[model samples]
Target: MLLSGHCLIVLERTVLAASPAEGCALLIGRRHAEALWVQRIWPCCNRWEPASERQRHFQLDPREQLLAQRWVRERGLQVLGAAHSHPSSPAVPSLSDRERSLGPTLLLIRSGLTDDPHPLRAWWLPEPAALPGPAPEALPLPLEAPLTGDLGE
Candidate 1:
C-alpha cells in the first residue's frame, strides 16, 4: 500500500533522527492520500550486544512498549512499522533483525551518526506465513521533517 502524504512526512523525520544507537516508531493508518492521518511513536530503547553478534541491537523498553500499546489502543491504529539507526552502517536490518520482526513491518535504516548525512532506507519484513508468498518489497522514499505539535492538537 502507498503511504499517505502525512505519514510520508513523519517517516522522513524519523529516519533523519535515527542513530546507530537508537530506534524510532511510526503509527500508520490504511487510508488514502488526500485524507492522511498518522502518528509518530518515539519509544525507548534497551541496548544490548548479542554474544554471537557484533552490532548492537535494541528492544523496546518496558515503558515505551506500554506507551505504544496504550497509544495503539486509544487510537485504534496499527504499528505499521518501526525504524532504527545504524551508527556505522546503513539502516538495513541484520539477520537478527529479521528473526525479531513480528509482521509485515517497516524497517528504516539510517547510516552514520544521528546528526550526519542520515540517509533513510525502507524495507518490509513479511510475516513468516507470507514467506514463499512473494518477494519482499523495498521502497525508497524521501525522508522529511515531521510536523510539530501534539497529535491531539
Candidate 2:
C-alpha cells in the first residue's frame, strides 16, 4: 500500500543480499482490490564507475539483473519501478541518473554511511515528467528498525 516515508521495506534474505552496500529498487505490484503485495527489487548500476574515483557510480551486476527479472516474471508482478542509493551523496538521482532512467519507474535513493550504526535518509525519485512541470517533490523514506529488531539479520 505504498509504504511511503520508510527505508528498507523489510524484504527477504534473498533480496537483501542481492543489494548490500550499493542500493536497491523494486517495483511493487498488487491487485486492485486486495492486500496481497509483491515486489521485484533490483540493484541500481553505477555506470559512472572509475570516472568518479570509484565513489560516484553504483551499477547492478549481471546476476542481480537476472534475478530481478526472474522475480518479477515468476511472481506475475508488473515492474512498477526501480530504486537505488547514494551511499555518500544525497538521496537524489544525479543528472546521469536521469539519463539512464528507463520509464515512469519509482526510484529510491539512500544516503549516509551504511555501517554507521544509524538510520539513513532515503528518498524516492520523482517521475521524470514531474521535474520540469513543477518543483520536484521527493518522498522521504526514513529507515527505522522494526520493533522486533529483525532486519533480516
Top-lDDT candidate index: 1
Question: What lDDT does the true structure give each of the candidates?
Answer: 0.56, 0.48
User: How much is 34 displaced in model 1, in angstroms?
Assistant: 15
Global fold similarity of model 1 (TM-score): 0.61
List model 2 lDDT by residue over 1-153, tens digit each: 243222245332223343334545554555445232333344344443553443555555556566767777787776555555555666556776665566455555555545544233323345565554432456544323334544354
Give TM-scores for every candidate, taking all chains together and pairing residue i with residue i: 0.61, 0.56
Per-residue error (Å), model 1, residue 119 = 1.6
Worst 10 residues of 1 by lDDT: 30-39
* Prediction RMSDs, each to the true structure: 5.8, 5.8
Q: List the residue pairs that clash in candidate 1.
A: 12-143, 12-144, 20-87, 91-109, 91-110
**Residue-wise C-alpha lDDT for candidate 1, range 1-153, written one tens digit per residue:** 344346655555564454434555554543344332334545445444562232466665567666776777687775666666565665566666677778667666655545545366667787856554444555655434445665541
Candidate 1 wrongly placed segments (more than 4 Å): 1-20, 26-38, 47-55, 113-118, 129-137, 142-153
User: How accurate locally is residue 99 in candidate 2, as Cα lDDT from 0 to 100?
Assistant: 52
